[model samples]
Target chain A: MKYSPALQGLIEALRCLPGVGPKSAQRMALHLLERDREGAVELSQRLQVAVDRIGHCVQCRNLTELEVCEICADTRRDAATICVVETPADVLAVEQSGSYRGRYFVLMGHLSPIDGIGPEDLGLDRFERRVAEEGVAEVILATNPTVEGEATAYYLSDALRSRGVKVSRIAHGVPLGGELEYVDGSTLAHAFSGRRPLE
Target chain B: MKYSPALQGLIEALRCLPGVGPKSAQRMALHLLERDREGAVELSQRLQVAVDRIGHCVQCRNLTELEVCEICADTRRDAATICVVETPADVLAVEQSGSYRGRYFVLMGHLSPIDGIGPEDLGLDRFERRVAEEGVAEVILATNPTVEGEATAYYLSDALRSRGVKVSRIAHGVPLGGELEYVDGSTLAHAFSGRRPLE
Candidate 1:
């Protein structure tokens, strides 16, 4: 016989998570029911609360419960330079690096004409308004290095240049700890093309 | 900046699931928020419902929302033979194989004295009561091949022999699809010792 209705429902519902499959879902459901009911309850409560409370920041379009996200609300951060990224996770990635001191603008997704996504869908109008009205000096394009991400960065650079703001894309190259032999061809090409002369 | 409070809480809670780490938790939480809010809501509702409703079946100690599980309630299944397994998942595994026509008794866990889990914790006394009252003729031990599982099986076999019930353990061998050359020494040894002559 199959699992009881509630157990079956939990397993099926858990499949919505990225990378989770039938076996993993079953394991997770059983693990929770058999050993960690408290954790399951906490997870359920937290998921519900997060879904109910979380929303996009009004100014930067990053995820937040407040109208403005923490980085966007901070006065100590440099407001003149904005780092544009494709998702909220990228904001966290940059923040964890502890190098960027500027605020951020989340595009939410890259331009994909095949998928019907465009500038308006990415809130570029709002971003441009912020740029023109706030006297922003530079915008860094930190979208992924995929084809769609490159196309998005190119489009943004064209748009921002005409608006009189300096636009720069994050560098692509071999990673710091990676060996040359294992570096992908496209990245090696990017490293060669964007090479700098050491003083 | 760190993830917003609600998002952070959701991510942290998601980590309660097995095989999910910080990165996977963030991805799952953000994925649910961005792409599958409906799924997230369903998951939350189902998890809450499952935890609140699901409990061990009174007769078999298997997980179910009712006093007796569907397998136990079904009259067509053989009541004279019982397949004793370690968990509800094992019950499903046996059912899916379409081989066993008998009812099941779930141990919930194996005997591990170091963890202070005893026969009472495994509901062995309840199992014994069923064997005595229900006229059960045979019991199949389908516990895992681990040391604890073997110990549990041996303990159950010894206890069941005195109750006028035929006790048997499922075979330990190289799996149907596995190559014998690559099989572990213990499994190979068990396979050799348990070999039966062709009729």
Candidate 2:
């Protein structure tokens, strides 16, 4: 079927996101055109505003409208402790928990050898330099529990260990009330290896 | 979770659209900040452009950036015949088939009662006027096969029958080679009843 090129273009553009597919894209495009004109416009405007105004924080590479991110700029945040995460999304997740009082360093991506993504690709040179110079007492590796996440955690550990920074990965295990059988193989294995003493 | 008010505001605004729930909106908000800044800006610009510029064509009530829609503006399309549809997206569907040579009359909605959407809400008066004045030979009611769609079609048929225009409803049946075993009751019954002479 020969759809209008304009309509097709909109759908294709929407499909660029991580999980959205052609059908979902079509629905989104139509919804934007029909109902949420303002919302769609806001989304588009916010995107451009963010793109033009926002960039990686000079300290942590987190998405920020300023040179230094909100976390880095906050006077109350512990400058001595830095939580290292793979993406800005992870930083958001940590922030949502509202428990961590430390600053953050967003790697912006994980180390995926199969995908040709490595330390250099993530600008780890800058990160290592920051870890050494910034007087950060401890670095918590909060990259996801995927293979790439683990690899990134290890890579960061090796790079920053020489600078005497205490590096640790985020704990991975069965979710609250999750059955052992229901847990994925990788997560289950990580849980077994990283087992802590039960109080 | 203590997200910034501005961030929370943006996410809530995003969830107003159909299919966009809280989680999806949150993900979209993060993606906008992190990866797809330019794309988001473009989308925002397009949304505004579409909302501000595109409106109903004075002649056919189809969506248009100008007073007359692209289909109505095209000299090659048959103005004498008009295909009536419920929404602008429905216009796209018909256009995608590449079969119809006529222009379109977009209702923008249907005769939804529980939702307080009536004939006036769908701009049916404009349709009646267009049919009355314009030399429209035939009106193909291509609304979706739903209750509101059926009622809208019936309403239009009764109104147009007195106005000396050929009014016809689009065919309802199973797709070609669609097995009866897989087909639903209503569709199967419709297929059996509307079955044509075997040549």
Q: How do the residues B1-199 of candidate 1 rate in per-residue lDDT, one tens digit apiece?
A: 6899999999999999999999999999999998899999999999999999999999889999999989899999999999999988899999999999999999999999999999999999889878988999999999999989999999999898988899999998889999988999999999999999999
- Interface CA RMSD, all predictions: 0.6, 3.2
TM-score of each: 0.97, 0.87
For model 2, residues A1-199, the per-residue Cα lDDT tens digits are 3334455566676765557887778777777777777777666555555556666778888766677767788998899998988877777788878879998888877888888987887889887887789888999988887778887888889888888988877788888899998889988987899898989
Instruction: Report lDDT (Cα) of residue B164, candidate 1.
Output: 84
Query: DockQ, in order, for the candidates?
Result: 0.89, 0.40
Q: Which of the CAPRI classes, incorrect, acceptable, medium or high, describes model 2?
A: acceptable
Which pairs, if any, clash in model 2? Answer: A44-B44, A45-B44, A48-B41
Provide the DockQ value for model 2. 0.40
RMSD of each: 1.2, 3.0
Q: How well is candidate 1 docked (DockQ)?
A: 0.89
What does the lDDT read for residue A79 in candidate 1? Answer: 92
